[model samples]
Target: MTFKHALMAATLAALVGNAFAAEDRMPPIPADKLSDAQKKSIELLSEGAPAGGAPRNVGAGPWVPLLRSPELLNRLQRMGSYLRYESAFDPRLSEFVILLTARDWSNQYEWLAHQKLALKAGVTPAVTQAIAEGRRPTGMTADEEMVYDFIDELLRNRSVSDPTYARIKDRFGERGVIDLIAINGYYSMLAAVLNVAQSPLPGGAPQQIPTLPR
Candidate 1:
């Protein structure tokens, strides 16, 4: 296939939606057929997807699939839902960890999405701006403080220190701590994928993230 043809195929594959397996593609979704929310989602993703014009080689294989694959996507989305229902940390805390992971891996697109969500989740505008700028949030709540500290430990040590883990264990009890680790690890893998893919950020995406320390 010509380069242009290949790029078209990739974009169409994404635009087609993968709410399930890519093999079991979504039926043709007409613009007019979509509800307002669904239509807006389609429009945003369509506008932001990479051009696919010149694919780059990274690591041993491709990276975007790990982000878009239905099985993994379902599993990961469940983590967000579970957090929303069962945890001390709110979605804003989740967003804080996501921003930390994205900044750590230099993944611009990840930062963009989570920053927007963090704000919507009631994270203060100043904190989102701070996170986007790669600085600490000015005053994260108690739960956010726990999450940020845990993430800082995880990235630095690749595992939380006994002290930090013990704190989370006490704060969240056993299951919550485990879920916290699972959630952070999930985002860590995601950040690595976006970094490896060199995922393109949306146009008008914030370009102001600070440079994380090496």
Candidate 2:
């Protein structure tokens, strides 16, 4: 096949796979078929999106399943807009937290979506690769390390240690601390939805993060 043809084929295959995966659960609803509330949710999701950002379709990432509950989807997009774009942490650190949450959840779609964002936001390739492999990434800056430890302890222990909490609060302020916690919780909630939905990675990409042995 020609390169263009090959790419188209891959995309079609991926769509087919996603259809099969989502049909029994929260299947993608076509725009034309969406209810008024669902359409509103899509509109809200698109309100602040960049000129050429992610698709406004129900099939895009978490929106597919989330569309089922338009109010939830709308609320989530509002909250996510703040956490993703206006969070106290730098974009690099925000994306690093997102990637870490994705890794922890083994959510392939989440990882696929944010890995590039993480890199583009200034997270080093080495750090991302280490996180993908479930290792303590070396070379993270002091702040990055602190953020990592904060989330790591929170996820593993169900609460941040006193020291970890203090470090982030000192560095980023109480708002930063709250944003940090909110980002983790927010992404984790999305991960749970995607996991329950068995959302496939876009374009038939192979899973990047390995499932932990448990």
Candidate 3:
């Protein structure tokens, strides 16, 4: 396996092994136990979610840890609203970036939640599967390839190379690039929260990402 693949394998193995034990690291904040600030955070988060209600409880998932800082949670929720619904890129492209971020972090909750949305957003099975397997996906359009490369370089290097930057900037312009980076950074933060929280997939939901070759 390549270095990236090997690293991913190691990370996944560690996370999988600790899955059960990590649960207590950050327990959910019960509604009755929520501070006034946390309640306000939930209200903002819920409003930013879909019209019906938030996909998951604000007291659950990554939101649990973030609840400790209600102001931060509120800001994050607003940023998340824009990235998810109002970004310059298409929803499919946004989802692609999120999936790659999810995989890089080996964040089970992130991967599980976005896998279906990625598919619905038209990220092909081949691309998602290849990413899950830690290989560069095949048969992506120029746009997909550009997005993949940009995200890949950013994750691996902490900055994009000049050529990659120019290509995306030319095609997407400054606002698009900013939005792209924002999505990646935001989701990565959420991944960290989820990882630390040891948030599991809902009940019996199967893990979508497989363990990579060690």
Return the lDDT, model 1, position 24: 15
Clashes of each: 1, 0, 0
Number of clashes in model 3?
0
Segments in model 1 whose C-alpha atoms lie over 4 Å from true places: 1-64, 67-88, 203-208, 211-213
Candidate 1 lDDT over 1-214, as tens digits, reads 6544654564455444322322312232454665565444333333422322122222112123442343554455445445534555556666666777777765655676667777877788887766555556767787777777888788778888888888788888887687777666776777666555544443434333533334
Tens digit per residue, CA lDDT, model 2, 1-214: 5544654564566456544555426667866889999888877776655433454444567888898999998888878877887789878999999999998887877898899999998999999988876779999999999999999999899998899999999999999999999998999999999889876666667756666433
- Stronger candidate by lDDT (2 vs 3): 2
TM-score of 1: 0.59
Q: Local distance difference test, per candidate?
A: 0.57, 0.82, 0.81
In model 2, which residue pairs have backbone atoms overlapping below 3 Å? none
Residue 171, candidate 3: how far off, in angstroms? 0.8
Off by over 4 Å in 2: 1-24, 50-58
Decreasing TM-score order of the candidates: 3, 2, 1
lDDT of 1 at 81: 48
Worst 10 residues of 2 by lDDT: 49-58
Ranking 1 against 3 by lDDT, winner: 3
**Which scores higher on lDDT, 1 or 2?**
2
Q: Is candidate 1 or candidate 3 better by TM-score?
A: 3
Using TM-score as the yardstick, the better of models 2 and 3 is 3
